[model samples]
Target: MSLEVLQVSKQYGTQLAVDQVSFSARPGQVLGFLGPNGAGKSTTMKVAAGYILPDAGDVLIDGISILTHPIEASRQIGYLPEHNPLYMEMYVVEFLLFVAGLYQLHGAEARQRVAGVIHDCGLEKEQHKRIGALSKGYRQRVGLAKALVHDPKVIILDEPTTGLDPNQLVEIRALIRKVSQYKTVILSTHIMQEVEAVCDEVVIIHEGKLVAQDSLKALKQNTTEVVFVLETQEEMQSKWFDDLLGLAKCHLISPTTIRLEAKEVFLLRTELMQVLNSHGLTLISLRQEERSLEHVFYELTAPRYNV
Candidate 1:
């Protein structure tokens, strides 16, 4: 499954919720929709799922517009909105049955699928529990089970991990990763770590517009890729590392370390060692830092042109 949002925008009265955002995701990949609170991430996901129409532009799944073919589009999509709704009076199995009916599933087919997803989502322990009686974690699992009941090719999840305990979060995240093996997943969240955990790509929105889209590795290099830790016999205050700050794109991260944003990393690494040797500095420790997603998030979300 492939999802494409083309120049989409949404407005309510005078407020624009999404501003001409465009992106695409493919099967076997999780495109992490990320932004701060009220950054239009949820609105974008809702629009893509056809729950909300865009005032301008269109959402396409496999080249079919949701507006022209809502049912067909929805048939290919399974959406778990930020606030999942459940009939409190319905038991876990009953709610799924009701949802299955909407998708025209019945008889043994529905029962088999419901059983499969219930097991996959870890809802077996609470299968007989009513929605109102279950804990928040179980409610979330129920929501996910409902989404999976139809076995759609595309899954759009909005803040799926919100309001869960740490253990629940880990379990749900693992389930999501397991499911993504066969489907296209568009996961919207304000949490940065979620993207780092399972996402293959990232689409960052800000103030109702698409700002940055890239793999996490490329984004980290926007600031610096090389994390150099040098501990010499000299005191921390020694100017040895300070002098190396004159190197292009080098940042002094600490008294003993600096991060280098070199254009040619391999050449720079060799040259850097030579420079250290020339300075009569004994390099006690030197290694490229593992690129981190937290650093990438900060750079991509930070105000452009310093605001």
Candidate 2:
């Protein structure tokens, strides 16, 4: 594992910010860290980056414990915080050089690394401008450039694309994907599309608890309820599908269209075909509905409604 968060917990006064939260990320893997506001996402990321200590448990980067050896662990991690704070008066290159200095990078090596990040983060056009004068999109690029300037093995990005426009979102997402080829990336974002676009796996936190963690494919497979849309040539009553085998429910979408919810999709598909054949109903179309990441997120995080 490139990054391991072992039973981490944090508390503020009487409130438990994180309760035994644990997860790991491997090199070249992009993990999406998701949660609603005040769900301890930032606190966990802070502990992972060695900026704050967990009340219990530990975080390790490349086998070095963050709690015991923060400096060593910090060397292996590049963090872009939610705010992306930067000095407004400083020139973009100057700011990067300053970050490079924090890593004790000096002379030709520091210059080369700064230049490399400038190119890598698509900041070449704004490298010479003052940080205050750059657009929000370019400012975000500068923040990312600073994070990558140290060439760390693990990257932690917290809401890195929060305020970006659609074009900027696309560009930043591409940059994250490019960097994940060689580093372990933990991206914190509320946007479902971002997770789908860049993450290999997803870890969801709800009320400071780990609710779901798995590959995108596996999560979908495990959590998705199979729904099928059926269109017939002739109108049919909704009750016609109420007796179908393995069906959870049926919806009357239109006079000639019905949507079926099934407990077992594969078995239901075959059974549906048989029923249609026996009834001599002309099937216009039948297809399974693909669940979106947004749906999964809501399902995992939403408050339960009692029947």
Candidate 3:
């Protein structure tokens, strides 16, 4: 493991932002730090990056404790926070060089790392622009580049894809995949597709408490629920699905769509298509949903309705 968060906790006055959360991140794979907003994802990451002192426990970057060896551990860890804080007045290349200088990287090494991140982060085109003038997506790239410029063994990115367009998303995902081959990466995000797209393993927190930690496959396999969504060109009637037998529940999302859930798999799909056909409705789309991290996340983090 390149990064280890050992029973870390943080409190903001009376409010406990993180409650003894613990997880490890291995190199050669992306570890997803998954949770709903305000679930202490950012705070935990800040503690690990040595940006804040934890109220309890410790974080290790390549085995150096952030609590005991703050300076030494920080040197081995790079963090791009949820809010990409940048000096607005500085040019992209200037800002990166400034960051390198703060890390005591001088002369040839500074130039080399700055150059490396600019190319790796796809920021070559935007490198000359002033930080204030760049678009949100490009700024995000700059922040990521800054995190990579140091070439730390551990990288923590909190919601790194916040401002990216679809094309940019693909490029950044590929970049992350490439970098994680040699370094440990902790990716924090609420977007299920982002986690599914890039993460190899997962660590989830709920209400500041450690909830689930496992391989992506294991979390997905823990559930047996099957979901199938049906979309039609014409508005679907609720009564049409009222008498469906095999389904555990039928939820009409809108006039043109319905979500069907079942405890068992297989025949529910066949029955659904047959019904739509019998009703003379043209099928626009029908897709059986996989047990996605999104579903698993909901189960783990959903609020208590009973309360």
Candidate 4:
């Protein structure tokens, strides 16, 4: 594993911000860290990046414990915080050089790395501009450039696309995918589309607890209830769908439209078609509803007992 959080926990006064949260990420994997506000995503990322100490447990980067060897662990990780802080007065290249210098890189090596990141992050056009004059998208690119300047093995980003417009969002997401080609990346974001677009695995935290963690495909496949929408020419009563095989529940959305819930949508489809044919009901349209990541997120994070 390139990164691992072993039973990590954090507390501030009486409230426990994080409670024994644990997860791991391997090289070349992009893990989406998801949670509602104040679910301790940021705190956990901070601990993983070695920016703060955990009250208990520890974080490891490439088998090195962050708590025991903070500097050494940090050297292998690149972190872009939720609130990106930068020297507004510094030029893009100047700032990158400054970050390179912190790693004790100098002369030709430092220049080369800065240039590499500038090209990799799509900052070549804006590299000579002052940080204060750049747009939010460009500024974000600069922050990402700074994070990648040292060629770290692990990358952590918090709300990386918080305020980006559609075009910027696509660009940044592409950059993240490019970076993950060789590094382990863990990013927290509320945008479900972003997760669908880039993340291979997802870790969801709710109330400072690890509610769920799995590959994106597994999460969708394991969903307990699969919904299907059907439209027909004739009106259908709620009781018409009650006896259908494999159906868990049914709802009459309109006189001619119905929604069916089942464990296996494929089975439900076949059974539904047979029933419709037997009853001579003309089927106008029938389709399996596509489940979105937002729906999965709510199902896991909702306050109700049944998930």
Please count the clashing residue pairs in each candidate, in the order shown.
Answer: 0, 0, 0, 0
- Work out how many backbone clashes candidate 1 has: 0
lDDT, model 1, position 40: 88
Cα lDDT for residue 211, candidate 3: 95
Quick one: best lDDT, which candidate?
4
TM-score of 3: 0.81
> What do the candidate models score in CA lDDT, each in turn?
0.80, 0.87, 0.85, 0.88
- Runs of candidate 3 with Cα error greater than 4 angstroms are 225-289
Candidate 1, run of 10 with poorest lDDT:
234-243
TM-score winner between 1 and 2, please give it.
2
Tens digits of per-residue lDDT, candidate 3, 68-173, equal: 8898889888899999999999999999999999999989999999999999988898899999998887888899889988888888999989868998888788
Writing each residue's lDDT as its tens digit, candidate 2 over 95-172 gives 999999999999999999999999999888899999999989899899888889999999999999988999999999
Residues forming the 10-long window of minimal summed lDDT in candidate 4: 298-307
| Model 1 bad stretches (over 4 Å) | 222-291, 303-307
Q: Provide C-alpha RMSD values for all models, in order.
A: 6.3, 6.2, 5.3, 5.6
Error of 2 at 94 (Å): 0.6
Error of 1 at 221 (Å): 3.2
